[model samples]
Target: MSDLRTRPTTKRPPTGDLAAEGRRRRASIAAFYTVLIVVAIIYIYPFVIQAGTSFKTDGDSTYNPLNPFPSLFTLDAYATLADVDFPLWFRNSVIVTAFVTVGRVLLCSAAGYALSRLHFVGRKFLLAAILAVMAVPGVVLLIPKFLILNQLGMYNTFSAMIIPLLWDATGIFIMKQYFDTIPPAVEEAARIDGAGVVRRFWSIMLPMAGPALVTLTVFAFQGSWNEFTHFIVARSSAETNTLTTGVAALTTGQFGSGNRYPLKLAAALIMTIPVALVYFVFQRKLVRGQGGGAVKG
Candidate 1:
């Protein structure tokens, strides 16, 4: 009888190249990290400068634009922000962003799920229309959007601010693409169990879509939070000013103040905080979305 543990004479493992392969892999990893660190610094340096400059005086910011540390830290910039209509602008921005993000997430996910799973009439046409709308350049829509808003009698109102952006084409597209990648077995099983459309999506599909939902949440939050273009064209009233519109008004027309760099920088820094928080919280998911073969239009 042959020994059970003995290998066949013709079957030999290759061992010599394993050590060389290990060394090659280690070298590649080191090079990759070196490049990553350099790229990270390039991306992060501007925010560092912006944060430091916000704490400096106007004169200090202009003189030491590249400095990552303030010569003499001061709260004068913040104080000036408090003196204006900043609080109101901040509140309006918060309200609009919250409504828009929630609306987009719910609407886009529903539409995406229906489009991906349901075999209804006009589905192909609806998808084609969405893709076509997504291709339309945003800059060219400025006047058209304003005209429609005026016609709808939503001009200068919160409805005007929120309605146009409630269900974004990009969000719908992202969700549809994500839903398409999911295997249909789960939903089929739910259907076999006599679960309805809502039940299947709510209990099975949406739970499995955790990563995509988190990604969508982050996108919606960032897009609505930092939105400036639509806000500018949608409303002209001082009462309707968001942080972006308000800051722009402050920065451009006040030439008598010798630039007001510190104040401007402070406003920018403050506005950036929400986006930074969202990014830090969901950075891992974002990396996965970009790296794990997720497609974006």
Candidate 2:
């Protein structure tokens, strides 16, 4: 017992060294937090400035571009927006976005389900065509889209705006991938119960796709809401101006001559609210949708 006890207690680490190691660990943690905070501030600073500048006067915004706080706060920008066709633009955007979202969800899901489950003559070729379409840059299609709308006499109408955005290749691809992850047994069991293709898909499969549906809805809403170029080419009437085009006109001196930075910023801020709310509300579902395919029974 004495020999065991006298074995120098495994030469315990020096108290000073332990204290220094703890200090080093704490310093590393503090440094990591400092870097994260700095990066967050860097990324968030512009939005903070934009919000503050929206409340500033024209002179204040012009002179104090970098400063977020306004020396003379005013509601002049929002007041000015009130006089413009802002409400009309907002209404147009809401109508277009609603129809586009619903159409995309239904159509993309149907196409995805067909691609995933149904075997057809040109299924492989059709999927390949869709992939090719996805590869093509959107800007390259602007002229073609415009020409098609003009040919169909859809120009300067809500149909032009809403119909063109109804089907998204990416959304279809996402749904197809998600459906592929589901077990065939689920659908087969429904078929054994005398369910038809439409009934099985609508009742048995669609409900299980909640995460993917939410994700698709969010994308469709945000894409249609913020879409600018398509709306630009699809319609030209002020009566059908979406928030993007209308706000863009504001920035280009559509309302007045001078810089109106505050008005522009306020319009941008207001336009961003719906998208932000959507992301916050459905963020969890979006994450789940992305990872759902990886989960197995």
Candidate 3:
């Protein structure tokens, strides 16, 4: 045993000199951080410019397009927003976003659970249909959606804006993928304890879907909040205008010409606040990036 231990068990040290290897390590780290910083600045600089322009006068904004600092910071642009339909648009967005988020939370999870767990007729067909719908581009459905909304007499109303978006194929897909990862034994245990389908799903499964639920909530809120083309065909009245449609109107000279950079940018800047907050709060879940309770197969 002593002779075996004395015999060299460890491999010889790598042939490269320590100093040279250390230099290479330092250089690689420097290169990686350099790339990271550049990418971060590329994303962050546009927002800086937007914020700067939002505080500037029209002339100053035009003259200093790339500058992210105003000559003299002012709230004039925000004040001008008060004079327009910005508040009304903001209110409509809040209402639509709240309703859509809640609806998607319940419906998407339920559908996902059903698709992933329940054994029922037409289940395969239904899942196939959802996948096919996801494969199609969203723009292709605009006219069909418009026609359906108009036919159902939901056009030009809040229902037009909210109902069609309450559940989506993508949300269903995410939830299903998550639910599939959950152990069948868990649900079976609940069943043996006299839990019904609804009981098991509601009391056992739903609570465990935290990551996925957070993910879906963020997507649904952001999608409905920023939805533009659908809202365009869904409603025509100013009363029904959400931030996306209302802000688009501002961009198209509805609020007058000559860039109006401050007003336009301020509106865009304010509208992004809620989405950013949601992202910040749930970013960890976003990173774990799965809604299924755990990753174990």
Q: Which stretches of candidate 2 lie over 4 Å from their true place?
A: 1-22, 288-297
Estimate the TM-score for candidate 3.
Answer: 0.92
In candidate 3, which residue ranges exceed 4 Å CA deviation? 1-6, 9-16, 289-297
- Whole-model lDDT, model 1: 0.86
Clashing residue pairs for model 2: none
Candidate structures ordered by TM-score, highest first: 3, 2, 1
The residue pairs that clash in candidate 3, if any, are: 212-291
Q: At residue 210, what lDDT does model 1 achieve? A: 66
Q: Lowest-lDDT window of 10 residues in candidate 1? A: 288-297
Candidate 3 residue lDDT tens string, 1-297: 355546558875576777788889999999999999999999999999988899998889999999988998899999988888889999999999999999988999999999999999999999999999999998999999999999999999999999999879999999999888778898888888888888888888887788888989999989988999899889999888899988888778567677889999999899989999999998987898654442221
TM-score of each: 0.85, 0.89, 0.92
lDDT of 1 by residue, 1-297 (tens): 976796657844578778888889999999999999999999999989888888998888888889979999999999988988889999999999999989999899999999899999999999999999999988899999999999989999999999888888888888888889889876787789888888887777776676788888898999998899998889999999999999989887663368677788889999999888989988987778542331211
* Collision count of model 1: 0
**lDDT of every model, 2 decimals:** 0.86, 0.89, 0.89
Off by over 4 Å in 1: 1-32, 255-257, 289-297
Model 3 residue 270 CA deviation in Å: 0.5
